[model samples]
Target: MEFKPDLAASNPSIDFTNELAQLLLFTGEVGVAIQQFSAYRGNLNNNFSFPSDIEEISQQPALDLMFLSDVISKVSGINRLIRGCIEINNYKELINYLNKTIELYKAYSRPNEQLKEALKGDPYKTFSNTYLKGFVDLDFAISILEAIISKCEQNNVGAKTA
Candidate 1:
């Protein structure tokens, strides 16, 4: 989509700062959390059974290698999307990026049946952030972010509204 700087000027209610901030923070947290998940595995396979001794997994040599590693990786591309959206004011692209992120996250996280079972009720609980606990709401957040980007487009900011 082409950039529309005029829309940003027309619509001044865009909350890019907060959106970008949250995106950056969550992406970082998710990345770190994923790293910590490494400790839950053994260089080969991760023990996913319930009631299993977590200490055992953290003690082995190869397993101990990443004893405190995270399972999620940092999403730099999301940051790039945030920057792109704010810079070019490409609200459409921003939405596309956020949508892509949601897809990627689901695709990567859906396979672990053990993790899925563990997350039974709370689907969006990333690492330890439990305020919204079970109510992840990132799917909603992406929509909101898109709407904000759209508003930015309407306001006619210095950049394009994509």
Candidate 2:
């Protein structure tokens, strides 16, 4: 399916840089939760935070959160597919899920110039880390899957064929 970026869903009316930074911050949360829950999880936190530089991220920094909304959505959807495979013991589906996940991740992890080319019409003209920003987004995306898994495990609702 062709990717469609959704700015409203991805960015919730916050500062763009800190918004990305916030996503990173929650990444740590997901890691910790996975250790504890080992089942379903939720959006670890609101947004991904930035690398802890002494200076705060600029409010007017170049990147557009809108551009990344679609990527995050794609990552999130893949996580769901993978989890569904695990729940049903569908080995073939699991293999396909992993393959697609890797392929999509590679495309999403491309460099800024490539992102610009693929995305087209980047008003910011800013650079993006191959996976840094998207890593959190992808992981955050996966957290929703984690939460669904948790529900099946704990509630036993569709656990057999989640």
Candidate 3:
């Protein structure tokens, strides 16, 4: 089903709640993807072995590439959810939730940056690194959440006009 924000609600609180619920759902999806990626990486590492046959040398499995693509897709979904939330009117409770999400994103940034730098040259190495996809997802989520928080603050200020 296509998720669309309720744009015509007369009550701003209900609208904000709906938007927040969508954000929370996507955030939970990211969390699940992170866990699944971690498990897949661990399994890949344990089973990985250099090919002894010449024919097999050129046929490496594309697990890392596939995982990276999955992560990008999920992050894009989160971005859409953030955009939906941005359409909702500002409320104090929504701002508080956004602040907490911003903090969570901040925590996800440090390791992501370090890993990106460390794996800069090779696509395989970069994508194969366990934390890269998770970090990239976090970074995207953080950027979108920050934008929503800034917009919400502006809306809050403009709403107080006499």
Best by lDDT: 3
lDDT of 2 by residue, 1-104 (tens): 55545443543321123323544455453343222221222323323433333123223222434434444454445445544444453434433444454445
TM-score of 3: 0.37
| lDDT tens digits, residue span 1-162, model 1 | 455454335544355666656655555544443333354433434454422343432323233222112222224555455555555545566556555655544543345555446544223233123322232334444554555556655766445522
Candidate 1: misplaced stretches above 4 Å?
1-13, 34-74, 112-162
Best by the TM-score measure: 1
For candidate 1, give the lDDT.
0.44
Rank ordering of all candidates by TM-score, starting from the highest = 1, 3, 2
Candidate models: Cα lDDT each: 0.44, 0.40, 0.46
Residues 87-143 of candidate 3 have per-residue lDDT tens digits of 554344444555665564454344465544454423344333454454445555565
lDDT of 2 at 63: 41
Ranking by lDDT: 3, 1, 2
lDDT, model 2: 0.40
Cα displacement (Å) at residue 86, model 3: 12
